[model samples]
Target: MQVMDPLTSPKIGGNHLFCYALLFILIASHVSLSASARELKVEPKGSVKDLVQSSKATKIKRTVNGLLEVVLVDAKGLKDTERFSGGMDPYVMIKYKTQERNSPVAKGAGSKPVWNKRFSFRVQYPDYAGGNGYKLILKLMDKDSFTADDFIGETVIYVEDLLVLGAEKGKYQMLPTKYRVVGSNKKYNGEIRVGLSFTPIR
Candidate 1:
């Protein structure tokens, strides 16, 4: 019987190859798992950051509930819609949220009209009725007896900041200011002077 040299034996060489293959497989599997763990950790952090940014972008500012008073002082440079009638009967239809009021007609006032009217509205911030509740819409119209009312021009007032400040200070007032009025033709047809006040309810 001849004794085989273990170092040069075929079986020993085969065993070495098998050990190297096993070690290579183990290292590759470990590297793959580490990369997967890193991805799992990094993805959530990015997602969380995106979620935070989105939340901030869509955040709604704080608002208050209160009574809002609007004063329609006057309007000037209005378009005379009743060219055939010689003079225009201009009046303003004021809207706040779901509330609506109409100013007394300035019959035959023509291009310039004076209302000096005060209107009141119950306001709740972030109105549930849809649309901007803090906005006041003033639609100027020429009232005609024989036909439909003519749309002269319109103006808008934003009172959200006023309401918020009023909530903080119990009341807020905006002195009469002139806002440009736009007509149905999308031109600056006139200007309207208006004042606003907000009183927050406790």
Candidate 2:
């Protein structure tokens, strides 16, 4: 058996060194190219500002005109006020943006009243929704002949959530299922069913 010493095998050593040198060149070239590619992608802070301005411009195009339709489906578990003897007369008040709509006084339905009424409000962007979101407010009240209507329960819903879910104008986007009513100190009293949708202005 003959063992060939690596030091004595110049041809073999040369081949091995050549292979390693080729591998090193390939690796170095790859790294250099990658670094140059990265350097070509220079994203400046002004690019960020440009992107923000582009976003604002697109939003302005969407700000043509829209109508937010809030439908007061029904409400349950309302506070039965001792301020009255019989079943309390209940109605729902809806406030969205700077617009408000009061449902017809459901004469004497008391707790668990049903309105199934729909209200619409005009929205010109940057006015109703210039910032983050527009909030939908629903308040249950008791109508009285002599005194002002009594507040039963209230809940607030944000249109931003639905809008972010890819709600386009002229399309109806129903709100979640129902909202629990919370009072002055965030007291839970009842749950109300409502639907929300946006439509392009005519």
Q: Which candidate is the best by lDDT?
A: 1
How close is every model to the real structure, measured as TM-score? Answer: 0.67, 0.63
How well does candidate 2 score on lDDT at residue 53?
57
Mark the regions of model 1 whose C-alpha exceeds 4 Å error after superposition.
Answer: 1-63, 126-128
Q: Write one digit per residue (lDDT tens) for candidate 2, span 24-109.
A: 89999999999999889666665434644554555644444667778888888887874437888888888876677999887888
**What would you estimate as the lDDT of candidate 2?**
0.72
Find the 10 residues in a row with the least total lDDT in model 2.
161-170
Strongest candidate by TM-score: 1
User: RMSD for each model, in Å, please?
Assistant: 11.7, 7.6
Model 1 clash count equals: 0
Model 2 clashing-pair count: 0
Clashing pairs in 1: none
Residue 64 lDDT, candidate 2, scale 0-100: 43
